[model samples]
Target: MSNPNLLVLATGGTIAGSADSATRHDYRPGQIGIDDFLARIEELGIPANLTGKQIANIGSENMTPAIWRDLHRAAVTAIGDPVCDGIIITHGTDTVEETAFVLDVTLPTSKPVVLVGAMRPATAVGYDGLRNFANAMRVASDPDAAGRGVLVVMGDRVFAARDIRKNRTRGTDAFAGFPRDAVGLVTPSALDWFGAPWRMDETARFDFSADLPDVPVLFIHAGITPEYVDRLVTTETRGIIVCGVGEGNMPDSVRERLIRLAQGGLRVVRASRLGEGLVDREPEDDANGFVAARALNPAKARILLQLLIAAGISDPAAIQSEFDRR
Candidate 1:
């Protein structure tokens, strides 16, 4: 049997970063090219037939909605190609969760679409990019990986897009699945899965052909004034996600302004500041037109809200239903 034909869309991150000193960690991200990256993977004799394309060679922290639109369009084109059996996205760890979630919610596929990144630069002696790339290809080639939405392969752990989060700044184990555990695990020798592949979000695939509306996230803190909230309530802004204290709470002064905005038909999501946990809707939430972010962090909540608002779905119940499902 022939190996699975994988189409790799490279959006450079630490995996493509390079440094002059192998001992030092300081390096410039996105210095390597797609050909070199794919060649390194082939040197390891990874079990796949590989083809590569460079989408954007920039740091993931610099990831924007425009790059996401192009990435989605390329993936869709690859999905339709008879030669492409699977798709792999080489992204940076800083914003992989956002990118994965965007693809998971907006791009549906029966074929595997795995996202992978590395902590160390490509030039490091302990360079993790090749191993991560190999494992990502493994997941993409695995028959069971199909229909599992978007997957992130990082440091032996494989996370589902809906639950993936970047947990730390500098470490091999930077990624994790919050509230939920990893869907699979991979190594040079073996592959193990905890569950069967399932559809991600079935309601709709959000169109990213145009510019997504600006929906800012406000991370609340002690002494954060209502003046901050007022800045987000502009004619051009669509929605807001407050990374509130405790159970998505803010000072009454700031809360009042958000409530007024929500009551006036603006979208407001109350997402927690913590890494993992649910922010359940309260009676005041329904009364004041707030959407509880459930288990979503502020970053993920912002993306969902942007997609919702861009689609012109403003009904609080309908938006809440999406926050519930997507």
Candidate 2:
């Protein structure tokens, strides 16, 4: 069979960085071109036809909803072309999970869209950017990888966009604990295997509006006053996500205010501040009338709320079901 065509969209991060020639240790983002990165892959003898585009040059923290829309549009347009087989996005490690999740929900494509990044900049010794990029390209080109929604490939592990998280700060292996079945690993023989296989649901193609809601997220801390909740509800916030303490538990005062806010027709979701475990409703826990956030973090929960608002899914029951389904 002929080789697959891969489009490498470079959004600036440490992966596309280079050391200051004068100073041996200092590095800057977007210092290297995608062509240069591809040249390294060619030198390593990876078999694929590669093309490059520089979408943006900033840390992932600086990425915005507007950029997400642009990326969605770009991926859609690229995949529509006859020569394009799939796409691999080079992104910053920070906030990469959020970007992957947004694209996974918004972009309506069965073609593989893989996101890859590196913890160490290209200037660092033993940098893994090129290897990660090559792996992502391989995953994107594989026809078996299609219809899995957006994927994140880092350190030879593949995760569904919905479940991956950056657990470590500066380690080469930063991604961990997606669903057991969603994890994709590369064996020493270079064969790809998935613990869980994901297929796109028919409901995955709902219209995604480019406009996003102005939702705010607030974290509930120990001995925290109710004023924080009050201010968020009374202010110009369209929605609110409360990062409640363990297992979606919050202080009594905060819970009371959230219940009142729900009654007032504002959207409120209860998510856990703890990293792991699912958030469920408990009657004795004072969490009545509040929607459970399930496995979503504060940022991701907010994104889901924004997407729901954009898609005109306002009912709390519907929103709760949507979160639970994934």
Candidate 3:
């Protein structure tokens, strides 16, 4: 697949950042347009035929569900197009994990869909975006990259979208595949895989025809009062994910309120606040009609929960099974 046709979707992040001078650390992100970004890649001596499109120019912190929907649609179109061999997304590191997870679960495509970001501004003396961008092209063009789900290539490793998380504010090695490591690694000249193809959710793809239901993530803290929990929740809310402490435990007061809410036909999931580890289903979860997040972080769990509700699967047990598979 030499000189493969790749669709590069740009949703501004640090990779497009620019500063007053090459050494100046302060800068504005998403300043470079997709046209200019593709030109820079051409300077790297890569053989791929790249086509660029700008979906949005905001920082990933301001990433919205609307942009996500557009991005997914674009990927699906690219997948079905015989001219496009694969898809690449240039995004901010802050919320790249969320965007990737949304596409991974919703867009079902065997063509490679790779997301890449840079920690330093494009004008920085040691700009890493160019290298990372080149690496993304290499991974996408690799024949073995097909059917590996969506991938996040950063710090020279390829991470499946299911477990990618940004752990650092600055630096090239800013992400980790928590509870799981990179499925493969890539460079400008080579691509390597650690194991056989592992598609976590081979049989499920979320429907995107309608607006995704908003599922809020509730942070559980010590000494939280029942009034605090009640004030934030309302009857119209469809689902909630509790980012609890240590194995997803919350204060008794908050837990009781959540249980009551769950019994009233609201979907609830418990996820850990800590960086690493899984939230297993406790003894009373089934009785209370609550679901454990399993291996997903709070942000990712919220996405999965939203898609579940949008698909009209309200049973907690059924949602739990999705948490198990996806």
1-326: candidate 2 lDDT, tens digit per residue: 88888888888888887775533555776677777877877887777888888788777878987788778778878877888999999999888989998888877556888999987788788888878887787788777777778889888888888888888887788778544434577522263756334564323445555678778888888778889877666556667888878877778888777777777777888887776757886664234556788888777888898898788888888888888866
Candidate 3, residue 247: how far the Cα is off, in Å: 0.7
Where model 1 places Cα greater than 4 Å from the true spot, the runs are 200-204
Q: Give the TM-score of candidate 3.
A: 0.96
**List of clashing residue pairs for candidate 1:** none
lDDT of 1 at 34: 95
Q: What does the lDDT come to for candidate 2?
A: 0.78
lDDT agreement of model 3 with the native: 0.88
Q: Arrange candidates by lDDT, highest first: which order?
A: 3, 1, 2
lDDT of each: 0.86, 0.78, 0.88
How well does candidate 2 score on lDDT at residue 42?
A: 84
Q: What TM-scores do the predictions have?
A: 0.97, 0.92, 0.96
Between 2 and 3, whose lDDT is larger? 3
**Candidate 1 per-residue C-alpha lDDT over 301-322 given as tens digits, one digit per residue, 9 for 90 to 100:** 9888888888888888888998
| Count of clashing residue pairs in every prediction | 0, 1, 0
